[model samples]
Target: MAKPVQLTWLTGAQAIRLHDAGLRPPRGPFAYALVCDVRDPALAALANLALTDADLADERAPSASARTHFRARRSLLRALAAAALGVSPTSVRIAYDSDGAPRVDGLPAFVSVSSRGPLAALAVASSPLGIDLEPFDASAEPVDAVLHPREQAMLAELVSTARARAFLRIWTAKEAYLKALGRGFKRDPATIAATCEAAQFSIDDGGPAPLPVATFAPTMGLGDLIVACAVTA
Candidate 1:
């Protein structure tokens, strides 16, 4: 049997340095990598990597902002592929399924990444894995529409978005679950089940049974983004 591969998370600068300059520790065999980001410097680096210089220069700053965010996502993904395959950052190739989940062709491992406004996170593993980081934001739209009636009731008891930043916890957990499946919002948001107790929980999916992923919902960041990670065997 193959030994379990380790999971590592890094910021954009860290990932770039680690991959391009060999500044980080060696990742063991079959490890999967994930990088998450919010739309900021991280996005800039990712965009610069993906867009041609001429095209980028011609792009209107405000109008192109959406593309910039998408490009940044691609850049992080490209870097992950390169790092995972032990190749030059430029040599990493990515292919995606109909769902837009990323995969490195011909590699035995799986890598996943996600980004939000100012933060980003990545996860890699021998087994499939997903990760997410979200800052608590009071302005986030009501999540009640997506929450299970039971889960919504529990969320009210555990924390109140009306009073604080409780939504980050649920959002992060949901994001993590989506990432784990490599399907993101493609799957019904409500189908992936978790409790508001701020811990890992299983999804109702039948295959092998979804495992409890990890959640890092700090008590004080109610108004901040909550982060979560899920893995499957």
Candidate 2:
């Protein structure tokens, strides 16, 4: 039987199933990443496999090596995705900043992936890419210190984090945009804010525009983790 690479969001406990579906690794210098809610052991194992068996050369140091299982799974998924898009896996390249924002090179654009647990997400773009996930924590304190005045007002007036679920929804959306742009934690989390209701971004300093909020809604809900991803059109 065949399995879909991604699953639909559902109510009740979020349980994700991960499978390689019997894929063979290809030779390449590749860049592949994924995001999953930390609760997902199956997906973690699968990711481990990708990083393990891949025939990719490390971008930071060509002489350096990756574990077999780790390269295998990540490389496999990247290969599969690239194959679907009619590109070569070996030609795929990944570069990252000190902040851990990953970018694909030698291709038309870039792609990135992040996984926490139950949720595994991928972002592909003709430009830079970013992805972020937050399980939603009301205990995390108000995010105002990092936001601009306008962003602070927006969060105060439009969003609610009293419920853990809603908090994650807003947090993930902002993080996704930051990651898509390769800013990540270097940028103020509060500076780039979103709302559960709006699911859009308000970036300080007039950075990149937010991605279409709808792109993330379809992949939401995996355990306590809520994920948001952004990419170039």
| Top lDDT prediction, candidate number | 1
Lowest-sum lDDT 10-residue window in model 1: 1-10
Per-model lDDT: 0.57, 0.46
Expressed as tens digits, the lDDT of each residue in 124-226 for candidate 1 is: 5557777777766666654776665655666666534552445556666677777767788877777655654434454444445445656654332223446
TM-score of 1: 0.67
**158-189 in candidate 2: lDDT tens per residue?**
44454445445556666666676677768777
For model 1, state the Cα shift of residue 64 in Å.
1.4
lDDT of 1 at 198: 36
